[model samples]
Target: MKIKSLSLAIISATALLSGAVQAYETGDIIVRGGLASVNPDVDSGNIYAGGVEQADQRVDVNNDTQMGLSLTYMVQDNIGIELLAATPFSHNLQGKGGLAGLNDFAEVKHLPPTLTVQYYPMDNSSAFQPYVGVGLNYTIFFSEKFINGADATFGSLELDDSLGLAAQVGFDYEIAENWSLNAAVWYMDIDTTGTFKNANGTGDYKIDVSLDPWVYMAGVAYRF
Candidate 1:
């Protein structure tokens, strides 16, 4: 009788231990912070200024890095809604291809706020979770300034705001019951028209720039 009682107690303890595994559940909130890098694959239209076409005047934008933040809420065991935010990103404009040597021709700062619905493709109790997300992105541009000869030639610069689609793939590796390490990569469709004006506002130029970029991030996440 003593031996049978001990066996039952051992099995009961094992079951309790198994139930202690932490998994994502409804109403869970996750917050993540890390570094994000934005690298643009630019395709720019020819620059037309003062009714004159500049030959091969394509543009290039340099990559920028900034602090990244993501907030997630679990609506179900495997479905999560996430919002991405970050510090303002700044990019330096340059000339590309036939219009080379126009580095730092201008600078602009912008913010991209994205909302995604994510699907996790693993059991909730698994230590590693991989997810795919599709969402919408809105980019707001401001603080545009010209540099070098471009400034003297074109006094005012502005970039049109963009509305586009965003896609992401990411994974989280569990480190503790409520802690995890995360890595993600995203592709965003960003198209903007840059307008430039003379110092006296007498003339204007327009260039359509496609700044589709790949964004990469890695950071730590905490669940509450």
Candidate 2:
């Protein structure tokens, strides 16, 4: 009877210690926020010549900075889901050449909300966590402004609403118990249509533009 009692006590103690270790290993909720920069390659096609030519027009977009916040829930040690929110980014557009020279520079707004499924393959003992996510983006354009020295206002430039696909890959390295350093890169494919009308309304033109942007971000994350 004494041996049996000792054995049971040992088993109970071992189970409690095991449970404590597991509780420490699994994180229930994580919150991380950071800043990102948007670098977009803007390309447009002319529809008038029956053949699509990559326009020689050079349009420069101002480098813009944006902030993002995300919440993650760990379903298991290796898998999670994250919802991303960020501030709206505004861009100025300018071009030169052909009829392009006739159009003035304009400003537009783009907002992208992303949700991704994350996978952490090395969650057991390593401080590095790598993840990948795929999501949808809806871009809204507003508050249009035309550059000075141009003949037309933004009203003369036509742009349609867009829905796009987004994908990202990033990683986080835990620097401390509550802080982690992170870096990520994302790709977004967005398409739009713009109509340019002459000031006299005599000549109307249409343009198809693709603004596929690549985003790079590096910042610190805090877990609560």
Q: Each candidate: how many clashes?
A: 0, 0
lDDT per prediction?
Answer: 0.90, 0.69
> What's model 2's lDDT at 24?
12
Give me the overall lDDT of model 2: 0.69
Top candidate on lDDT is: 1
Candidate 2 residue runs with Cα over 4 Å from true position: 1-27, 47-60, 96-104, 151-158, 196-203
lDDT of 2 by residue, 1-224 (tens): 99999999999998775443331135667777789788877776654323334465445456578887777777777777777666888887756455456443677777766667777766444667778878776777766555565445324665687888888898888777657888888888878876655565555556677888887777877666
Clash list (residue pairs), candidate 2 = none
- TM for every model, in the order presented, reads 0.91, 0.73
TM-score of 1: 0.91
Q: What TM-score should be assigned to candidate 2?
A: 0.73
Span of ten consecutive residues with least summed lDDT in model 1: 15-24
